[model samples]
Target: MEHDYYKEYYELERNHWWFVAREGILSNYIHRLIEQGKLSSKDLKILNVGCGPGRSSEYLSKFGKVTSIEYDEFCCEFASKKTGLEIINGSITELPFEDNSFDLVCAFDVVEHVEDDQLAVKELKRVTKKGAFVLITVPAFMDLWSHHDVINHHFKRYKIKEVNLLFDTINDGNKVFDTYFNSLLFLPIYFFRKVSNFLKLGQKRKGSGSDFEAFKPGVLNRILYKIMYFESSVINRKIRFPFGVSILYNWKKF
Candidate 1:
């Protein structure tokens, strides 16, 4: 990822509709697990892999102890300062931790950035205790690939089956919940990306910016956040959408 993009991301993550809504969705899932007696908030040990600017790590801290790791040194420093947590400089494919270490592990929008995504997933599972939860989120569909993916240095988007297959590699892992989210705006986002590609916008500029750069906080932002937040409520009921802009998977190592 470009340096400037990281700076932009740090600034926008707090209030951006995408970040805010995504966090809400993830939080809903965690809260649901606690409600089901599958997880306990007290004394939970969480490993937040690829914790970019540490917002998610900070949020995860509310549940229990959070160990954050980031590949970029700059992001490690930035996140450490922002969250006041000791951020480890590390790679997901080669996590610096003992086997079966964490009660809960998360790698949101991280695996796609790795060239060897399988190794990343394996490492994630390796450090997670038996019967512990692993939560992952990734961009959905190769067809949805756009400047947003490119600027973010993504390897590829995923189909539901593909994501399932990735987790299936771990014989001991059972998928407890999975869904495609950001569904409400998929059509509009797809159309916008198509039009932007046709216009050759940002095509010539590699390492320029991301889709988030175009977003400005306003009524529309608030509306989108509310829409996704409602979608999250449906997801908490284990209701699944047929398709969406991103995929979320919740797995338990057994």
Candidate 2:
């Protein structure tokens, strides 16, 4: 990620439809776990892997103490100043922590950035305490790949089955929740990306842009947020979606 991109992210992450809605969805899941007595909201040792820009660490702070790590030194500095929390500089494939360190581990949209995603998953599981939880989100479907992925330096997008296999290979955890989110906008986003790719839109600029750059705050943003928030409400009711723009999964370490 470039410095310019990080600057844009710091500005938009607070209210962008994609960031805000995804946070809402994940918060719902965490709240559900608390409600079910599966998790406690106080005194938890939480590890936020790949804590880009630090908003996630700030948000996760509500549940308990949050220790954040980011691969980029710039992101570490940017996030620490923004949130006033000390952000550790580190990599997902080689987390600098002892085994069974945290009660909750979050790696939202982080694994896709790693070339050795399996090693990344292993590291996530390694630092998690036995009986603790790990939550992850990743872009779904290679078919939906676009300039957004390229600009973000993603190694690959994921399918539900691929995610399942990624976790199953470790064999140290049980999957508690798994669902495809952003389902409502999947078709619209799919078509837009497809059409955009067909016309070679933004291909000339390549690394110079991303989907985040397309966001404009207004009625459309609010509407998209509301749509995804409603979808999250449905998901909290234990309804599973077959497919969508992204995948969110929860795993409990054994």
Candidate 3:
């Protein structure tokens, strides 16, 4: 990301509806794992791969100990200050951890940035304990690609078929359990981005979101959150949506 956009992200993450809704989705998954005895918050050792400013890492801390890795020094510094957790300056393409180092590994919106996503997935599996879960989230659909992707240095957006194919190649023997989310508002967002792309409207025409400002009522924010939260509730019940703005997966290492 451009230098200023990182600042924008840091400032907005705490209050943005998008960020809050994303956390709500992940939080539901974590809590369910606890309920099913698949994960124990107190004993888990977690690796937060490519955590942007460690926001997700900080959230994961409530579930277990979290160690973060990011390739950028700026992100490492910001995340360190925000979470005060150990932040390693590293890349997902080659995580600097020994085999089976963590009980849980999370790579959210991170793989798309890597040049070799397959290798990155392999590293995620390599670092995780056998039968441990790795949660991944990435932007969905190549058709949705625009300057937002270019500005963020994303290599590829994903489709459900291709994403599962990557996992199967390096399966290590576990099945892929996954879903598409950010569903209800996908059409509006898609059209908005399309128009924005056609007009090339962005922060200083840089194809970034930093200069974009949003003002909404507290009620509005809450309503949006609730709508998304309801979709997450559907996800929690183990039903996967057929299409959405993003894709999420939970693959257990074997």
Candidate 4:
């Protein structure tokens, strides 16, 4: 049976303010990739690993041919309907594709849920072309664990050094372009949330209705989006963060 909570959250994400804000952040990141000449509409074949409901693929398709791979059959179906792109259903440990077939492979906010993140990274490396970009975003800091992490089945959040270690065994030719944290606003909030959870202070996964209006106040949402856009641009130029809610990384095969 499908996890009802996951499904409901995804449906909410389809039109949620938090979701739109995240998309804007991604757009800024993609723009930077374009500015660096890493993404091109004419030649790049983009793959979005663990693509949820295909929103990222739809955004990325403007730059290249996009194919999204999702493990959930429902997500894949929804993604196909939403983006009109091909959706492959499979595990990250075993990507259903030929080696060196894509120019860009992206997995956003996905690695933490995998039991074997190292194998998952290796699988991603195997499917990309030489010097192809591998972009990933994952929750940062295991210390920030909360009820959300428990409900989401997250094995562990990442530390920069820990993630770097996972890439150590990857082909020597593969180079890390950048690694940095994202969601600056949520840093302190997450710290407190984690602390609260750690203390067992009324810890519970907020149901779908909770936070439904967190972003509904459009003024706040728009302002936050603009701030994040600026922050994202700055970070893309150079990855540096004392801490954050999530991490974004860029790597390329040699």
Model 1, CA-based lDDT: 0.88
Ranking by lDDT: 2, 1, 3, 4
Cα-based lDDT for every prediction: 0.88, 0.89, 0.81, 0.72
Compared with the true structure, model 1 gives a TM-score of: 0.96
For model 3, name the residue pairs that clash: none
Q: Per-residue lDDT for 9-126 in model 3, tens only?
A: 7755666677788998998888888888888757789999988866788888888888888888887887688767788998897889999988889999999998889898889988
lDDT of 4 by residue, 14-105 (tens): 65655665676677777777887766647679888988767777787777888888888877776577557788899899998999999888
Q: Pick the candidate with the highest lDDT.
A: 2
lDDT of 3: 0.81
lDDT of 1 by residue, 1-254 (tens): 76566667876778889999999999888988998989986899999999998788878887889999999998888767766889999999999899999999999999999999988999999999998999999999998888778878999999889989988984788999889999999999899888777876656544355677556799989998898778988999999989999999999999
Instruction: State candidate 4's TM-score.
Output: 0.85
lDDT over C-alpha atoms for residue 70 of model 4 = 85
For model 1, give the 10-residue run with minimal summed lDDT.
200-209
Candidate 2 error regions (>4 Å): 204-208
